[model samples]
Target: MASSTIIVMGVSGSGKTTVAEGLARRLDVPLAEADDFHPPANVAKMSAGTPLTDEDRAPWLDALGAWLAERDLAGGGGVMTCSALKRRYRDRLRAASPDVFFVHLTGDFDLIERRMRERKGHFMKAGLLRSQFADLEPLQPDEHGVAIDIGPAPDELVERAAEAVQRA
Candidate 1:
């Protein structure tokens, strides 16, 4: 959509990666998985069932921001799957590029928690779901983006999000 960098954002198990990949396919751009950028320490903490403090997330977010900035400067765009739980976290990404946009995936906590429980081999624990929701500040009034419920299947959700991006 308009060649801007897209951030498919939501807490873990909300299908951010699935949606981002589908959108990138539709948009003909690359897809970046936020989990790939996490430092070993961050991964270790998550695997140990410890939630990341803002301090712990700063470096990871910076690395992601830098990636976005570099892609933007090169006049190319991609979709990134990140939690971006807090407003400040999102602001950090937006600071990377003027055309940065977010797509918030909203869903019932129980639904997502169930999904998390069903998932295997992910560093993030199902117990961390509540902390994520607690920290989340949904897209603000002035934010440039779209918010969609994550109840549907991946294909439908991606289509809806892509439509929103097109409209934006």
Candidate 2:
């Protein structure tokens, strides 16, 4: 039931990459990090602690969507990490692959900020988390996904996401 492609989505500090990595391993599918799809200009701006506008994200989203489409075309599936903070962005991805299912990671701001602070070498610093939260729109009822709490350890979170995908 369209569980082939899974998207681990949340704000910048919600442990999307970590959980997605584990999920991909658990699911035995390819995985992609949304950051890798960004253009140099976009990465430069974000690395400077600036929040990206929708305009800056469009092309990046398109590229990531295309990647999903390619995986789907191959008759297998994959997992990916994406901030997908807005519904419109998720919509763009869905357009590329209608079966795309999202695993929305959610947690307290305090926990997320602490996570962002502790992580190293990430372009998205702790300062931008507030902006991401401000822009975040939780998955609606119509969306094909579940909201997962990020309080548990990363492995636990991944397990929860994997279970959700199977159920989907």
Candidate 3:
């Protein structure tokens, strides 16, 4: 199969980092975290429990796209995390790498909120989950990716996503 940048996307607390890490290892490719691409100002807003405006995310998305472009050009597509909750955001990544693939993690709101509350040392607060869900646009039929539910164990979910991503 042709290589394509894999974007592990979902709302915060949806195990994006976990799945991305495992998938990167399984695929033997480098990994990048979308959170690391965010500017300090954006992190501060989310830390304060305020939802980020589209303006706050533009630079972050561009940075991720650049990362994808770099890896795609290198002929070794890698994995990355992003709360690509909108179709337009995903489109921006696709513009950078036409074959970009998304592994969208989905789960019940209550379950995801519990994971967020249980997480520590993270800038994002559980309170902002509502805003994230409000902005989420799941993978469309025409999109080049798969949607995997987050209900299973972390390893199982990663295995399932890795298989789908590899097949695609």
RMSD of each: 0.8, 1.1, 1.0
Q: Candidate 3: lDDT of 96?
A: 90
List the pairs of residues colliding in candidate 2. none
Q: Write the per-residue lDDT of candidate 1 for residues 45-147, one digit (tens) a residue.
A: 9999999999999999999999899888777788899999999998888888767889999999999999999998898999999999999999997888889
Candidate whose lDDT is highest: 3
lDDT of 2 by residue, 1-168 (tens): 333788999998898889998988887789999999999999999999888989999999999999999988987799989988899999999999899999999999999999889988888889998898899999999998999999899989988888888888
Clashing pairs in 3: none
Worst 10 residues of 3 by lDDT: 1-10
| TM-score of predicted structure 1 | 0.97
TM-scores, in order shown? 0.97, 0.97, 0.97
Clash list (residue pairs), candidate 1: none
